[model samples]
Target: MPPKSAHHALQLEHERERDATQGFEPKGTFGFIRYLEHGFPSSLVRWHYHDEYELHLTLESSGKVFVGDYIGQFAPGHLVLTGPRVPHNWVSIDTPEEGVELRDMVIQFAHAPLETLAGVIPEVKSILPLLHRALHGIEFFNISAQAHERFMRIRDSTGLPRFIEFLTLLGELARSSDYQLLSTIPMQSTDDDAALARISSAINFIVQNYASQFSMKELAQQLDMPERMFSRFFRSATGNSFTDFVNRLRVNKACELLMETERYVTNICYDAGFNNVANFNRRFLELKGMTPKAFRQQAQGRFGA
Candidate 1:
């Protein structure tokens, strides 16, 4: 047997109550609601996805957002609408957000169950382009700028009215031509519980501790598998060595820091898990398409950060 097929225990339907409530209504007018007051650590939740769609209106803080092969950084005032099963997490726990205090309202729609919204709302006609583009992961340009004026109003309203206001925004999202897909390959999800369990555990460990020094032996031992075999499986599944994945993660974090802060290059190099300045500069340039300084200057100039 091929390791005796495994399965995923996490069913999004169970968690639908929390995401559907609080303006992210699922299943119509009467549904449960869940509100959260979490921050960076909360962003480290994991790499799992459910059937519900997630919409985030982030007001403060900056971090790298991941969805399958798409890797991009985000800043305050970002409005992101993601389809189901897009495994994502933002990595930025050290920096404190300024202005507006890093508040974000994440609404999850059990639209998976309703699955017929597009058929019902013909206003969503214009959204087909956006939805098709979203197969890769759609990002609205200057989400903060394009949607800010209305967001201020949405922030103040609550209850059913809030739901309507949110729906209007969704219509805008559907019609938005100012969007881009971060990548093309949809993230992998096997119905096997065993495979998902191991992958999730590995992803969680890497996300939380990638900045620190650790070894595959240490990690494999923790996972209760032989080191070599574990490394083989991990690389095969993710398309890269474990170390390479961690390094890519580190580089992604460095990009976010470069785009969002005034921190010095050397300080950022160390902070992003590189012990040598030369290596940091080289790797950052190799992966980000520009030297660290150039990248920062360009991002800052564009955002006026």
Candidate 2:
């Protein structure tokens, strides 16, 4: 058998591989709340989802923020609230500085604790609507410099002080009117068990096998339902047709690859499960409002690639 160090290294490698393939992971400390500070070009900067609700403040950077299917610009003083299990990432524009540190301040907490507290203190429920809006992710705009200072204070404090500061921040955000919903579609959650199960299965299958050619008939059969019935149910549950959902996933993957790699557009289209270039270009333009080449160029210009 290998040494203990070798075994630990192997375990770390396996965990990383799992994270690369399966995007969902638990983040931060396993407590009521967790605080994290990160610099640019860190390993934590990636496209991944977590079960915690994240209150993120940009400290020193300007770049694009991707939440679910929405992508937009972000800069210093940009604040966002992301709900549980929403895929999100922030890519900073490249800078000339060699060793910049601490570009973001992040706070994450579980929903259950807040919900429990709200049950006891009704006043806390005022933020419930804001939490609901975070299901699609919320970007707070025109945030004042004082609000940014509060975020820094939250990061600097500990224990109950940190918790109180966080609650105060939430109260202010809940009352503020300057914000935008980033995602067009909300992450579906339903009380109907059957509908939830069916939709979850369908989404998981697509995420796991997005590179393959999707057949609606085959998917319906796999779900043990007729094609027409499955189509209706999918639309009702997701607010998107089966074809549109698949196309959006493919387009999203294409966008990631376009920004992250130097692959040819045609090759990226095929790799993203599109059969041909023309359809890919058409769908890309329709979804992203730009050609793949133009998108890449724009991203390159922003990142100084």
Q: How high is each candidate's TM-score? A: 0.64, 0.58
Error of 1 at 269 (Å): 3.1
Tens-digit lDDT string for candidate 1 (1-305): 01212221222334443353333334544442222324444422344565556666666677667665556776676667666666655555436544233456565555432336557877655555555455456677655565665555555656776666666766777766677776445454556667666766675577667678778888888878899998997775565688777777788788778876779999998888888899888888777788999988898889876
Q: Write the per-residue lDDT of candidate 2 for residues 57-148, one digit (tens) a residue.
A: 88887887877656666778888999887767888886446634878777777898899999999999998898999989999877757677
lDDT of each: 0.62, 0.76
* Candidate 2 similarity to native, TM-score: 0.58
In model 1, pairs of residues that clash are: 6-192, 6-193, 6-194, 7-192, 7-193, 7-194, 8-193, 21-33
Evaluated against the true structure, the overall lDDT of model 2 is: 0.76
Candidate 1 structure lDDT: 0.62
lDDT of 1 at 239: 56
In candidate 2, list every pair of residues with a backbone clash: none
TM-score of 1: 0.64
